[model samples]
Target: MSNVEIRPVTPADHSVWLQLWQAYLHFYDTELPAETSALAWQRFLDPTEPTHATLAWRGNQAIGLGQWIFHRSNWTVSHNCYLQDLFVQPDVRCGGVGRQLIEHVLTQARNAGSTNVHWLTQATNHTAMRLYDQMAKRSGFVQYRHAL
Candidate 1:
């Protein structure tokens, strides 16, 4: 973890981003369309796009990914950013890669005029929940999702 570095994701990072993204999918036991990944990668690099992400690098390897977006907030006094996806390779979990990625995102959000950053994770994701719970105050809110 000594050489781990977290930086904004760019279009030039397609291949390495793919590796970490695929590992994230494997962790959730889910399958995603390749086109969707490509689209996301492109959108992240588009400065006009609302959603952007950062990739964590450990030496020459991409180790983690985080996708976040900003929008007007009714709860907060000002706009805020929502972290949509955050994942790190299981082999290197809890080694500070994820933390660094999150911190970097926070910096980005602040630079974007966002007053707060928020995100959600599966309740069963104990390893991630541990880190998340310690980062910010956990509101007792429940989420409901409906698949189209």
Candidate 2:
């Protein structure tokens, strides 16, 4: 595997970011409305928005993507980082891109003075779980959602 360069998304990265983002949505068998996707991309570029995204590049090719948001936590005075999305190209899995993307988020969270960096995945996402197991402790809390 070649060296992977992970960096925050810039307007010039829109095309590559969309490719990775679409692949991520496909992996979960999900789809978002075109408007929603556009909004998300715009939010990532908005400095006032707490949402952000990063891409892992191998040479000129983008191989992974990560999206996170910062928010206040009732339990702490500092901000908390929620890693909302993570995906690595199928051919590059297990080659360290995913971990690098995650570490990028952690570093950003730390620099922002966030209390913690956290994420969630379905129980069936075994491959990612393996790496995650080595990176952080499980919070042991079940998530309950009330969607509008």
Query: lDDT of each structure?
Result: 0.87, 0.95
Candidate 1 local lDDT, 1-148, one digit each (tens): 6698888887679888888888888878998899998888888999998998888888878889999988887777778999998998888999998888888889989988899899988889999888998888887999998999
The true-versus-predicted C-alpha distance at residue 59 of model 1, in Å, is: 1.2
- In model 2, which regions exceed 4 Å deviation? none
lDDT winner: 2
Q: What is the number of backbone collisions in each predicted candidate, taken in the order shown?
A: 0, 0
Best by TM-score: 2
Q: List the residue pairs that clash in candidate 1.
A: none
Over the full model, what C-alpha lDDT does candidate 2 score relative to the true structure? 0.95
**How good is model 1 by TM-score?**
0.92
lDDT of 2 by residue, 20-54 (tens): 99999999999999899999999999999999999
